[model samples]
Target: MKKVVLITGASSGLGKSIGEFLHEKGYTVYGTSRNPDKITDSVFRLLQLEVRDVESINNAVAKLLAAEGRIDVLVNNAGVGILGPLEEIPTDEIRNNFETNLFGPIEVMKAVLPQMRIQKSGLIINITSIAGYMGLPYRSVYSASKGALEYVTEALRMEVKPFGIEVTNVAPGEFATNIAAHRYHVRVSQASPYGAYAKTIEVINSQVGGGDDPALMGGAIYKIINTPKPNIHYKVGPFLSRFSIVLKRILPDKMYEKMLMNHYKL
Candidate 1:
């Protein structure tokens, strides 16, 4: 049977790419957006879903189950990026990032798990970030939010294993997505103490503009879905980004920090 897949935040960017790719590969793909009526060119079905709202999450899940009767895969790809100095970022904004990047995905997973468990098979893939593996300048909140979801996947995967559910995190490095345009930025004044912080945004944007293809993430997700035993985490990006995680594993604490500082020109 063709697997049924539900992908959130699929209005555009990586989520849209993944959804389109899977649709071509013959999976039944349902992509979600706050306003599905506006996406006129989607190759697959689009559902109206707002991850921040629990009712929206449940309704979308319930609707999909009603149509398909079983959901085989879920891509928790709905997330927003936050930028600027940590100290300058407001507490409420930080919480909001956690809400969308962390809590929202959790709620979507919760809504799908019962039906998945009943079927005795399902896969949950959380779209995380390479930045989640490290603390980068001006992206402290984004990193922390994605990083928390990574940890949640670690524990949740083990807990759900007995019922045949597989949970994993897919961390993508900078991709040429409009994530930059949509990010929640903490505007710093010209005389802010964190002078280097403002300048780093340029470098970050340049990298993302020149980043790897977003379809690569789709390919990565497709492969993981086919694998008999998908690992806890799958990273898709430029070699340096993926290797940075390795460097973090072996390099001394301060040395790794220094490398990042130098990379960001901080």
Candidate 2:
């Protein structure tokens, strides 16, 4: 029997790449996006879904279940990134980020667990970020969201292991994607005094211009899906990402802060 894989946030970026790769590998792939009308992929079936909405999730799951009868893999790739100083970023924007990045995946997991439990076999892959393991200057809220997701992935892995269900978290560092292009709802105020960091912020945003390719992340996802026993967390990207994770673990807090300040020339 062919396995069925459902991927959210499949309109573009790593999610779209994973959908295409898995579909070619013989899995029945269902790619989801908020603007379903925009998704006209002949490679995989596209379903309309917004991970932040419960009703949207339920409807998408019903449509897939009715057609496929079972879901073997659930890829929760829907997320948003909001970058700015913590004090400057609006509280509502932070809440919205959590809704889409952390709670959204938890909602999808809830909607799919019943079916996976009944089947006694399944895999859940959550697309987190290397930011989940370490913090950065202007991405406080985004980092917190991914950190919460990492915790959820760890808890779910142990909770569902007895049922023969596998949970994997994919943490990719600075991938080339339109996430920075379509950065939703970033409000900057000239009234604020922290304007000195404006140029630094611009430089950081510009660096996102030539990050790692999204295809590499897609290939990493493919490998994790096919591995006999995948690790709880898989980090993808350049060597610097690995080094950053290690530095976070070993470096003193003040020294780490100084290092980041110097690296960004802040």
Candidate 3:
């Protein structure tokens, strides 16, 4: 029997790429999108899933379980991003960020765990960010959201290990995707002191525009799933971004912060 794979936020970007690539590899791939109409892949089944909505999540999972006897891989690629100074950002927006990026995945994991536990085999991959490794300027909330998710994945890996369930956090450094269009910019006043950093937006945008192809990410994930035993964390992206994870570990606190600032030209 073919392995069953379900990916959230599969309308486009890395999620869509992964779905399409895995489908080509002969996995039974089911993808979820907030606007089901946005999923254009003919080979992949699109399920209506608004990760922020509990009912939508439950219904989607139920439908998948009904159609497929089991889901071998669950990729939590559904996430939203916010950009701005933490102090100026709205509380509701912060909550919205966490709701989609953190809580949404947690809820989905809860819904799938029982079935996975009973089967004694499953792989859960959470798509986090390099920002999680080091909080970036003007993207504090985005970094915090991913950081928290990574921490949760750490604990979850241990908890699920005994049941033959594998949990991995795949942190992509940067990719050329529609993520720029989805990033919410916190409204900042002209009088705000932090307004000077507004130029960082363009810098970040340029970085993303030149980032690596997401097809590479799909290949990385494919290899991960096929591995007999995978590690708890994997960083997929450009060499520098992947190296940043190591640099952060060996460098002193202030030196690492300065390196990040210099990278963004802060």
How far out, in Å, is residue 143 in model 2?
A: 0.3
TM-score of each: 0.98, 0.95, 0.97
Name the top TM-score candidate.
1
Query: Where is model 1 more than 4 Å wrong at Cα?
Result: none
155-260 per-residue lDDT for model 1 (tens digits): 9999999999999999999899999999999788988998887678888989999999999888999999999899998889999889999999999999999998
- CA-RMSD of model 3: 1.2
Q: What is the lDDT of residue 138 in candidate 1?
A: 89
| Clashing residue pairs in candidate 1 (N, C-alpha, C atoms within 3 angstroms) | none
Model 1, 36: alpha-carbon shift in Å? 1.2
Candidate 2 on 180-252: residue-level lDDT in tens? 7766534567887666467656766766676788878768877887887889988888778767888988999
Number of backbone collisions per candidate, in order? 0, 0, 0
Which stretch of 10 consecutive residues in model 2 shows the poorest summed lDDT? 180-189
Candidate 3 lDDT tens digits, 68-173: 9798999999998789888888899999999999999999998888889989999999999998988889999899999999999999999999999999999998
Candidate 3: pairs in clash: none
**TM accuracy, model 1:** 0.98
Candidates 2 and 3: which is better by TM-score?
3
Clash-forming residue pairs, model 2: none
